[model samples]
Target chain A: MSVTAAKGFTAAGVAAGIKESGGEDLALVVNNGPRRAAAGVFTANRVKAAPVLWSQQVLKGGAVSAVVLNSGGANACTGPLGFQDTHATAEQAASVLGLGAGEIAVCSTGLIGTRLPMDRLLPGVEEAAGRLSEYGGEKAALAIKTTDTVHKTAVVRGSGGWTVGGMAKGAGMLAPSLATMLVVLTTDADLDSAALDGALRDASRTTFERIDSDGCLSTNDTVLLLASGAAEVVPDGTEFTEAVRTVCDDLAQQLIRDAEGASKDIRIEVRNAASEDDAVEVGRSVARSNLLKCAVHGEDPNWGRVLSAIGTTGAVFEPDRLGVAVNGVWVCRNGSVGEDRDKVDMRYREVGITVDLAAGPESAVIWTNDLTADYVHENSAYSS
Target chain B: MSVTAAKGFTAAGVAAGIKESGGEDLALVVNNGPRRAAAGVFTANRVKAAPVLWSQQVLKGGAVSAVVLNSGGANACTGPLGFQDTHATAEQAASVLGLGAGEIAVCSTGLIGTRLPMDRLLPGVEEAAGRLSEYGGEKAALAIKTTDTVHKTAVVRGSGGWTVGGMAKGAGMLAPSLATMLVVLTTDADLDSAALDGALRDASRTTFERIDSDGCLSTNDTVLLLASGAAEVVPDGTEFTEAVRTVCDDLAQQLIRDAEGASKDIRIEVRNAASEDDAVEVGRSVARSNLLKCAVHGEDPNWGRVLSAIGTTGAVFEPDRLGVAVNGVWVCRNGSVGEDRDKVDMRYREVGITVDLAAGPESAVIWTNDLTADYVHENSAYSS
Candidate 1:
C-alpha cells in the first residue's frame, strides 16, 4: 500500500498498449473525501513535458481530486498538439470520475519527443477508474516504471493517528535541482494546501534534490502531495513535516539503490564549509566528477581526484586546509597524503567519501553511483 | 621538428627511470635567444600541482629560458615537499643550463598525489641538458605522454620568415577553463613579452578553451609561448598572431581526436543565441552530457537529449523556437519532429550537432568526444 496506506485514497493500475512490450502503462489515484488539498513540484528544466505544464496549472488551484500517470512516452517536446493531448487526457479522466477537469492532474514518463498513444491511453483511464480500489496501491506503483528495476514505496505514521505514504520511479538521470523522476505522496491529515505545500517543499529540498546519479536533468520530473483529511487529526505542523520528510528520504534512498547499471552506491559528505550552499556546491562538484566516480568504481581510494573536483568549485575552502577520507581511513590530511590508502577497504557495495573543507560548521550529503562500463552500455543503446 | 621547427630552440627527452615501464619521462626545451620574452597560461583549478604553481610564478616575470616537463608523476597533493621537489628540479635545470632558477619553468603530468623520484630526476635533468639538440623536438613531444596514444605537434609559418610551432600532450581530463594538457609553443618572431602574451591569450581563448573532451579539469594544465627572436624579422603582428592561433588550433583538434577511448569526434555548434556567452554556455552544456555522448557513440540520432540539455541552461530561448540538426538532417524543428530522422546518416567517426536557439544572431562552436565503454575501463584502472 503506497498512496492507499493513508485513508480516503483509492488507486488502480491498468495495462495499455502504449508500451510496445504491453506492460501496465496507466495508473490512477483518487482522493475520495472531505478535503482535496494538494501541492506539487515540477522539473526545473524549462522544456517541460505537456503533462507537466497541464498539471502545474491544475495544482495552482490548491486541490486535486485525482492524478493520472502513464509510462511509455514522456510527451515532451511535442509542442502545441501535446498540450492539447494532455488537456484531453485530463478531460477524459474528469468525465469518468464526475469531477471538473481542473481538479485532475496528469503525469507522463518515457521516451522524449514522442506523442503518446492517446487511443489506448484514454480508454485505459476509464478502465483504471472502473478498477479503483483501496488496496490497489501496489499496482499503481508498478505501472509508472520506465527503466526502474523495482518500484519504490515508503510510509511513515504520525503519533496522532495520521500517516504519509509515497511512491517514486527513477533509475537514472538523477541530479540536483530535483532528481529526474516522478513521485506521488498521499496523507490523511487535516491540513490546508499551504501546509501541504510547505511540508512538501521542505522535505523535497533535502531529499530529492541531493541524489545526483548521472547529472542529467530530465524534462518530465514531478512530485505531488495530496491530502484527503479523512483521518481528521490536525497534528502538529513539525510532526507532520517530519513524517513527510522521512517518507521522501526513504524513497530517495530506494531510487539511488536501484540506479541504472550502478554497482556501488557512493555517499559524498561535504563538511566544515562556510555555508550550507558552499557545502552543497562542493558536494555536487565531487559527485559529478566522472573521473572520481570511475576511481570509486575501481576502489582505488584516489583522494587526489576528490581534491581536483573540489578545486573546480567556487565554494569557500583553502586547498592546503582541505582533508579527505575514504571509508573510515583518512587518506589525505591538510591537502596531502595522510594514512595508508591500502588500509582502506572498498570491497563492499557502499563507499563513503568524507571531505572536510576545514572552513566552518556547515555540511551537506550527496548520493551518487560509480561510473561503469555497464552504464555506458545502458545509455548508449537506450533509444535504439 | 615541433618546438625545434622554430629557430633558436634546442630540446631533448630522456628516460629518467621514474616510469615503471622505463619509458622516456623527462623533456627539456631551451630558448637560445637574444630575447627570452615569454608568456604562459596554467590550469584554473585552485588545487594546482606543485609544478604548475612553480611555473606560474616563473611566468610572472615575462621571461623564461627553459621548460622542464616530466610524465611519470604529477607531484600534486604532496604537501610542502612537493613544492620543494619542483623547485629542486628547476634549480637542477638552471644549474646545468647556467641560468637563474626563476627562468626555468616546470610541468608534470601523471598519477596525482605522488612524489617525483628526485634521485633519478635530478640526474636526468643534466642528461637532458647535455643532449639538447636542434632536432630533439619530436623526442621532447614523445616524452610527455602519460596515457596519450600519440604525440601531438603542429607548425605554422608566417609570411615574413617567422615560424610558430608547438607540442601538446593530453588524452583525458580535458575541459574548459583550459584543456587538461601541457603545451609549449616556440616562436622565432621578433616580439616582446607583452605582444606574445596578448597573442597567446587571444589564440588559446578560442582554441584550447573550446574543446571539452570529458568535462574534467585537471590540476596540472599549462600552456607556454616562448619567443627567441632568432629570425631577426619583425613580422607583421597580425600575421604572427594568426600563425600562433593556427598552430594552437591544430594542436587543440589533435587533442580531441586522441581523447581517451573516444570513438566519434563531435562538433557541437550553437547558433542564433542571445550572445556569444549564451552560445558557449549552451554548447558546453550539450557537449558535457554523457547521455548525448553515449548516443553519439551508438550512432543514434537522439535530438531529444540535446534539447533536454539546452533546457537546463539559463540561456534565452523559447522552448518551441528551438531547432536541432544531427548530421545535417533537421530531425527536430521548432522543438518538435521535423524531417525524418532516418534521413540522418552517422556512420563515420565525425558527428555534427547544430542547435539553433533562434533567439538572436550569435553563435559558437565546441568540440567534444563521444563516450564509450572503453572510457570507463581506462579510467577505472588508471591508477592501479
Candidate 2:
C-alpha cells in the first residue's frame, strides 16, 4: 500500500490515452479526512511546468484534498495555454471529487513543450474518481512512471499508531535541489499544517536533496505530503518527523537505484569537514564530476580524479592533509599514494568513496551513479 | 613553426622511453634572448602537479630561460618524491644548457599519481639539449601529445617585424580557469616582464578561460609566455596584446576541435544579460549540461533543456522573457514555443546555441562539446 497504506486515503490509476502506447497514464489520490493539512516541495528550477506553477499556488493555503498526476506530457513551455490546461485539470478533479478547485493539485511529466490531451484526460479523471480504492496505491505509482523500470513505494509506522507512506517515480533528469520526480505522501497523523510543513522541509533537505544521478535539474519536480485525522493518534513531533524522513530516505534510495542506464550506485561520503556546509559542498562537487563517475564505472579506483574534483571546491582542507579510500582501501593518504590500488575490489554494483579532509568532525553523504556508455546512449536517443 | 616561429627561440623533442609506446615524450624550448622576460599561468586546482608547482615558482622571477615538458607521466600526487623528480629534471636541463636551475620551468601531462622514469628522462633531456634548433618547434609540439590526435600551433605577425607564436596540447579534462594542457608561447616583441604578464593575463581571460569541454579541471594545466628582445622592435602595446590574443584564440579553437571523442564543437553564446559575469555564468551552465549536450548530439533542438539549464543559474532573466535558438532557428522565444524545431539543421560539425536573457546588453561565449557514447567509452577505458 504506498500512499493508501495510511487510513482515509483512496487512489486509482487509469489509461487516459495520453501515452501513445495506451498504458496507464493518469493517477488520482484523494484524502477523505476530517483534517486536510498538506505541505509540498517543488523544483528549484525557475522554468517550472504549468502544473508546478498551479500546485505551488494551491499549496499556499496549506490544504489539499486531492492530487491529479499524469504522464506522457510535461505541459511546459506551452505558453499561457499550458497554465489554463493545468487549471482545467484541477477543476475537473475537484468537480468529480465534490471539492473546490483550490483544494486540488496537479502534476505532469514526460516530453516537454507539449499540450495535454484534454479531451481524453478529462474523462479519465472522472473514471479514476469512480475507481478510487484504498488498495490502489501501487497502481497510482505505476501510472506516474515515464522511464522508470519499476514502481517505488515505502511506509513507516509511528509508535503512536500513525502511519506515513509514499511513492516516487523518476529515472532521469535526476539531480539535487530535487530529482526530476513526482511523489505523493499520505499520513494518518493528527497534526496541523505547520507541523507537517516543518517536518517535510526538514526531511527533504537531508534525503531527497542529497541524491544526484545526472546533475540535471528539471522543471517538473514535485513532492506533496497530505495528512488526514482518520487515525486519532497525535504523534510526538520528533517521532512524526523521523517517520517522514525515513520514508523519504527510502524512496530517494529507490530513485537512485532506478536511475536511467546506471551500472553502479556510488556513495560519496566526505568526512572531517570544517562544517556541514563545507562537507556538502565537497560531496556535491565530487558527485558531479563526470570524470570521477566514469572512473567508477571502469572500477579503476582512480583517486587522483577524486582529488582533482575536491580541489575545485572552496571547502576547507589542506591539499597535503587530504585522504581518500575506495572500497575500504586507503588508496590515497595525505594526498599521496598510500595503499596498493589493486587491493580495492570494485566488482560489486555498489561502490563506496570516502574522502577525509582532516580538518574537523563534520560529515555528509551524497549518492550518485556511475557514468556508462549506456547512459550516453539512453540520454542521446531519448529527447526530454 | 610554432614556438620557434619567432626569433631567438630554439626547441627540440626526443624519445625518452617514458612512454610505453616509445613515441617522442620529452621536449625542450630555450630562449636565446638578449632580454629574458616571461609570464605564466597555471591550473587553479589546489592539488597541483609537481611540475606545475616548480613552474609557478620559476615564473615568479619573470626570467624563464628555458622550459622542459614531458608526456606519459604527470608526476602528480606523488608526494615529496614527485617534487624532487621535477627539481631533478629542471636541474638536468639547467646543467645541460649552462644556466641556473631557477631559470628553467617544467611541465608534464599524462597519468596522475605515477613517478617518472628518471633514468631515461634525464638522459633524454641531455639529448634534447644537444639537438635544440630554431626549426624544432614542430617536433617540440609533437612531443607533448597525451591523447591529442595532432599538434596545435598558431602564429600572429605584427606589422613591425615582430611575431607571437605558440603551441598547445590537450584533448580531455578541459575546463575553465584553464584547459588541462601545456602551452608555450614565444614572442620577438621588445617588451618587459610586466608588459608580457599584463598581455598574457588579458588574453587568457577571454580565450583559454572560456572553453569548458567536459567540465573537468586538471591539476597540470600551465601556459607560459616568453619574450625575447632579439628583434629589437618596440611594438605598440595594443598591437602586441591583440597579436597575443589572436594566437591564443586560434590555439583555443584548435583545442576544442580536437577534444577527445567529440563529434561537434558547440559555441554557446549568452546575450542580453545584466552583466558580462552573468552572461558567462549563464553560458557556462548551459555548456556543462549533460542533457543539453546529449540533445545536441542527437540533433534534437530540445530548447526546453536549454531553458532548464538557464533556470539553474542566478543570471537575471524573467522565465517568460527568456529565449533560445539553435543554429539560427528560434526554437524557444519568450520562454515558450517559437519556430518549428524541425527547421533547425544540425548536420554539421559545428553548432551554435544562443540564449537571450532579455535582462541587459552584456554578452559572453563559452565553447564546449556534445556528450556521446564515444566520449564515455574513451574516458572509461582510459585509466587517467
Candidate 3:
C-alpha cells in the first residue's frame, strides 16, 4: 500500500480568502499512524518565509503529526508579526488535534512580503485538523497549490511492504536550485532525520533543482518526509533510493509541466565538461538563458544562443572544444556550424539539446520551460 | 547639418543570397574624403568571431575607408576557416571597389557557426559598390537587418560644422553588459582613434550596457565608428562624446522597444544604493529577472519578484531597509507589503519601478522589455 494509502491520514481544503479569486486557499493533513517520524527540506533562498522557518526548525526534532499549508499569501518578509501569526496558526492546529504546537509543520505559498489572515487561517487550520482521514492526500495536494494548474502527487510502493507518498506545489518564483522544494513525504518505513536529509538532498539535486525556468528562487519552500514504520521491511539499497528519486522526479516534472503559462518543457544536457561542477555551471548557464528559452518556445534551434550561453561561464575551455546538438542532430562541431543543419527537425513539444564541451566526460542536465507570451499574461494581471 | 545630411558619404544596399527571403542582404558605405579614422568595440563573448578578431587587429592602424555588411549570417565560431573567409570577403570587397583590402571592414549578422555564401557574396559586394549614395544611410541600415522587424539609424550634428551620422542593427541578441553593437559613425571632425575609443567606451557603459533585456551576449556584436574628417574640425571637450551617446541611447532604446514579442518597456531604477557598482548590479539583477519581467507583462505588480531578485545580489543591505515602489507608489516599505499596494495601478503601457536600498545616494537605471509570447514565437521559429 502507498504511504498515503496507510491508516488514519485525513485532509480538507477550503477557501480562506487569500487569493483575490477566493479559490482553494488552505489545506490540512494529519498523520495518526501510531508511529511518527518526520523530516523536511526547505528553500535555499536566503529570504525565506516565516512558515518555511517555522517548518524547518520544527522538523529538526524528528516527530511531526500534522502539516498546515496555505496558498495565495506567502507569509514572507512580514517580520516578527508574520512569525507570530504562523505560531498562532500552528497552535490552533495543535489545540484542535490534541497535540503540542511543536508537533506540527506549516507551509505557505503565493505572493511574498504579505502577512497571513490569522483569524481566517486559525479557523482553517482547526477545521483541517478535525477533518483528518486515511484518504486525504488529494485534498491536501489541491489546497497547497498557488499558480500551479494541477495538484502534484506521487505514490510508490517498495518491495516487502513500505510505501512513500509525496505532494508538491509551485508554478512561478521557481528556479528551485532547490526552488520551492515544498513537499510533504509520507512513508511506512522508519528512517532517521539524518538518513532522510541525506536522501532528500540527493533526490532533490536531480529533480527539483533541475527546474531552472526563470532562475527565481521562492521564499517558501519546504519538503517534509514522515515515516510511520508500519511496513515489515523497507526495500534495500539503491532500490529504495531509486523509489524516493522516482517520487521526487515525478513531482518535479509536474512542477515544470504546470509552469506558469509554459508552452513547452526543454531539457538541456551538457556533456564532456572539464568536471561535473563545470558541467552543472554550463547546464545552468543555458537553462537560465532567456534567449535560449525564447528560442525553444519558437521552435528555433538557435544553437548560437546555446554556444553564447556556455561562453559566459567562468569555466575554462577552448572555444573549438565546444560541440552542440539539437534533438539528437549534430548542429555544431568543433565550435562551427555542423553540416546539414537544415535537415534537423527542431519542432517538438519536448525539445532536448546537448552541448558537448569535449573537455572531459563529466556532465549534467537541466530542465526548464520556454519563455512565452502566456507566461507574461499569467503573471501580469495583478499584484499577487 | 545632421550626419545623414553630411557630405562625402555614399551608401548602397543589395539583395545578396544571405537572407532566404532575398530582401536587402548586403550594405556598403564609403567616405569620399582622403582621410579615414575609425574605432570599434567587439563582443566580449569569449567565443569571438573571425571578423571580430580580424577587425580588432586592423583597428591598430586606426582607419577604415569603407564597410561591407551582410544580414542573415553572424559568421561567428567559424574557427580558422571562418577567419580565412572573412579575409577573402574583405579582399573581394576591396577588389570590386578598386581599393586596398585594409581600407574595408566586414560585419555579418544572422545565424552563428555558418559559413558565408562567398560565391554569391563576392559578386554582390561589387554590385553594391556601384549603388552607393549620400542618401545611403537608410540603405546601409536596411542591409544590416536580422530578426528585427525594423531598421535602426541615427544622425547628429557635432560642433564646428562637423556632422556625425550613424547606423545600427540589432534586436534578438541584446543583453546587458553588451550585445550586437554594429555601428558606423561618420563625421567631418578630425579625432584620433585613442580619443574615439575612450569616448565610445564611456557612452556604451551608460547606454548599451544598461539595456540588457535577455541577458545573452551575441558573438556577432561589433560597433564600428568611423570619422572621415571631411569637415576637418574636431570639437573640443565632450561635445562630440555627448552626440555619440545621444545616438547610442536612441538606438539602444529603439532595440528595447522592438525586442521580440515585447509588450512593455520597463524602466527599473535603483536609488539610494550603497555604491554605483552596487546600484548597477541591483538594476541589472532586477532587469534580468524573468519572473519579474513576466509579472510586468501580466501587469501583476508582483513586488515579491522584485524583493526576491534584490536578495540574490552581492549588494549588502538589510531586507527591512529595502523600499519598493511601482509607478511612484510605494508598494513595499521596510521589507513588508505596504498598505497602499492595493491602491496602485499597473494598467498603463509603460511601467516604472523604483527600489531604494536606503544606504546611500548612488543610483542606476536599467531599461528592459517584458517577456512576451511574440518573443517566444520569433526566437523559436528557426535560426537553429
The RMSD (Cα, Å) of candidate 2 is 1.4
TM-score of chain B of each: 0.98, 0.98, 0.95
What's the residue-level lDDT of A226 in candidate 1?
A: 96
Candidate closer to the true structure by DockQ (higher is better), 2 or 3? 2
Among these predicted structures, which one has the highest lDDT?
A: 1
Question: Quick one: best DockQ, which candidate?
Answer: 1
Tens-place lDDT per residue, model 3, B31-50, is: 67656777887777887777
lDDT of 1 by residue, B255-359 (tens): 989988899999999999999999999999998888899889989999989988999899999999999999999999999888888898999999999999999
Candidate lDDT scores, in order, read: 0.90, 0.90, 0.77
Task: Kindly list the per-residue Cα lDDT of model 2 for residues B33-78, writing each as its tens digit.
Answer: 9878999988888889999999899988889999999999999899
Superposed model 2: Cα runs more than 4 Å off: A172-179, B172-179
For candidate 2, give the DockQ: 0.72
Ranking by TM-score: 1, 2, 3
Q: Which 10 consecutive residues of model 1 chain B have the lowest summed lDDT? A: B171-180
In DockQ, how does model 3 score against the reference complex?
0.55
Q: Per-residue alpha-carbon lDDT of model 3 for A1-384, expressed as tens digits? A: 123654345567777776668777888877775666777777766667889889877887788888888987889888879889889988998899888889889888876777777878877776676666676678778878776778888888787777778888885323453234467777776566666667777787777766686787777877777766666455475666677889988888887788877788888888988898898888888888777887778777778788888888877678987888988888888888785666667566788889998888788888888877777666666454
Residue A204 lDDT, candidate 1, scale 0-100: 86
